[model samples]
Target: MNSNSLNNKALHVNLREADMQFFRYNCGGWKAAATLSECYQPDRCGPRRFSFVGGGGKTSAIFKMAEELSDLAVLSRPGAEKRKVLIAPTTKMYLPRDGCVLLSPRLCEVREALAVEPYVVIGQRAALPASAFEPKIEGLPSSFLEEAAMHADVVLAEADGARHMPAKAPAEHEPVLFPGTTDVAAVMGLDCLYRPVREVCHRPELVCRLLGVSPEHLLTPEEAARLLMSEKGQRKDVGTGQEFYVLLNKADGPEQLCLAGEVAKNLESMGCRHIAASSLSPAEG
Candidate 1:
């Protein structure tokens, strides 16, 4: 496969399509081929509301999706009109790495930002190092996110908090997903394999309680996969008929890649039909 072609394809995808053509481009016939045992198409349905949960690359997924959607939004429009992609979180989060950020939740200010930039971040104000301008913008409220949905071409929301951990098990009230979320991508980092649960998993106790394992137990690929596929794992709070997508991220080396395959198998066994394993580095604007 031509690496350049894959990158270009991925860079142009509109998240609303629900067709992972870029995924096919990157994974070749292995993961993307319809004949493959693990293959399943994500539902190409409405709203384009994606709520990213789980650990690992939630932030990376949000930014990457935002970047891709922004490109498509701009390309879909003609002439000087700019289309917008909004990155908000149901929970707290740092500011976006690039683009204009609006602190106010009011719709007028958000519209003004969209007028100037295709990519915009909206949230309340938070105290942070002045140099970290984006982090200072606390995430917007859920109601505002629903309101913003009508205006932006796509809404990518980071619905869970992991406190920067590579893995996690959600608490009872965690993941705060929006009611309109059409797709929920549960992310897991492959690097956490073989590490002690306490060392790798956020909310280690929750992981232990749900998995019925000790916090110090070494995390196996199977165990990690089970955590994400468990009823209380990715399935929690997902509305009826909502789609679930598993993203096994940080498959950066041979060992991690192998583990990612196993995780995919486990997810499929547990009824997660749509899965993608990738090493997503930060995308530059």
Candidate 2:
């Protein structure tokens, strides 16, 4: 994509509220729209709601999109009124709900510094006391997952990994404790189970297998775009009908990046025209 293309019209979705504001200024001029719930219906447009299950790079990815697409309506949790950007100090301390709350202190510090909310922070979970747990938390309740999905325009769920021992070394691992994955599993019930895979090694076939759907059924970028238009009841752009885009956010590790590339290629082959891939980070350039 060309630098000039960055100014194109798009919809932005993000986990960090502060980043939304940053993008408003950097990406030419754009609109904002928050997904009030987790599951966003690609078929419907106008206004929609979606939920956010905090964790992973998904939140960062969403916020980046929201910033890029500044002209659209931005949707977010009504309760996220304080509008703080949180950065967890350690991996172990990140609890979806509480993490956002605890970072209020760091948020305050950073907001004061930047004259803008801090996009990241470093701290331990206050509830742990000494910073360790015997078995660690197992999983999230199905009810909570469902509730989050209900409010999002498109639920960005992490469907890999489960709560377990952390892996060691050059190989990167996906922590199995994602609430979004658990929610999807529960929603699809016995019908869906995301097979665990090494973070970088995950393949489209594996995802298809977990969903009990065919690899061929995976929609291409163009196909995804067409579906979005049809579902949202949008007319041809007149000039260009593209109203939104999907960001396939991946970890910075090489293996995960490779896997993301394959997925992007597959989506392109299938015609998902509006999808793009990027790494998750909190700096503006």
Q: How many backbone clashes does candidate 2 have?
A: 66
Q: How well is each residue in 112-144 modelled by candidate 2, as lDDT tens digits?
A: 422232222222334443234331121233444
Candidate 1 global TM-score: 0.77
**How many residue-pair clashes does candidate 1 contain?**
2
Residue 90's lDDT within candidate 1 is 75
The per-model lDDT (C-alpha) reads 0.64, 0.28
- lDDT of prediction 1: 0.64
Models 1 onward score TM values of: 0.77, 0.30
Give the range of the ten consecutive residues with the poorest summed lDDT in model 2: 184-193
Error of 2 at 277 (Å): 2.5
Candidate 1, residues 1-285, lDDT tens digits: the string is 111111121332222333222222132222443321122232243446778888856766676556645553424445634446777777767644445666664677666555556566666655563354334345566677777777775677778777667789888888788648777778777777888889988899988888899978988877877888777886678876777887777766667666777777676676766777666663211
